[model samples]
Target: MIKAIVNVSLKAGVLDSQGKAVHHALDSLHFSGVSNVRVGKQIILELDTEDKTTAMADVTKMCEELLANTVIEDYEIELV
Candidate 1:
């Protein structure tokens, strides 16, 4: 079996309203020295195949097609 860890984040120059909200909340809570905040998502997939190469390809395809919005989000895939 193989495990694929996918991280999806908004691309640079894209506005992250959720991240901004979190940052504001932190500030309100007296959390100082907080600059920019970015929010992302992680997806863990377990595959039945043992081949690392195939798992990587399949996971990449899944991220590009359904798991992420390629137009504004970037994804990183890790295979284990």
Candidate 2:
């Protein structure tokens, strides 16, 4: 079996509203030293296949196709 770890995040040039909201909330709470904040999504999948290369490819495809929107986001995959 193989495990796939996927990270999805907004593109570098894109605006992250969620992160900005959290930053504002932090400031309202009197939390100092808070600079930039970014939000991301993580997904973990357990695969029945044992082949590392194939599993990685499949997971990457999944991320590209459904897990993330390439137009506004970038995704990374790690096989474990």
Candidate 3:
């Protein structure tokens, strides 16, 4: 079996209002030393195959087609 972990984040130059809100909330909570913050998505998938090549290709396709908005988001995947 293969475990796929995907991380999705806004592309460069994209505005992250959610991240800003979280940052402000943290500040209000008295968290210090945080300069900038960005929010992203994490997806963990379990597959029945251990073929790295095939799994990577499938995960990449999944990311491009459904997991991320390529126009505004970037994605990376890790397999275990």
Could you tell me the lDDT of residue 1 within candidate 3?
98
Off by over 4 Å in 3: none
Question: Roughly what TM-score does model 1 have, to 2 decimal places?
Answer: 0.97
Using lDDT as the measure, what is the rank order of every candidate, best first?
Answer: 3, 1, 2
Name the best candidate (by TM-score): 1
How do the candidates rank by TM-score, highest first?
A: 1, 3, 2
lDDT of 2 by residue, 1-80 (tens): 99999999999989999999999999999998999999999999999999999999899889878999999999989988
lDDT (tens digit, per residue) of candidate 1 on 52-73: 9888889988997999999999
RMSD of each: 0.6, 0.8, 0.7
TM-score winner between candidates 1 and 3: 1
Better of 1 and 3 by lDDT: 3
lDDT of each: 0.94, 0.94, 0.96
Per-residue lDDT, model 1, residue 27, is 98
Per the 3 Å backbone cut-off, how many clashing residue pairs does candidate 3 have? 0
What CA RMSD would candidate 2 show? 0.8
Error (Å) of candidate 1 at residue 23 is 0.2
In model 1, which regions exceed 4 Å deviation? none
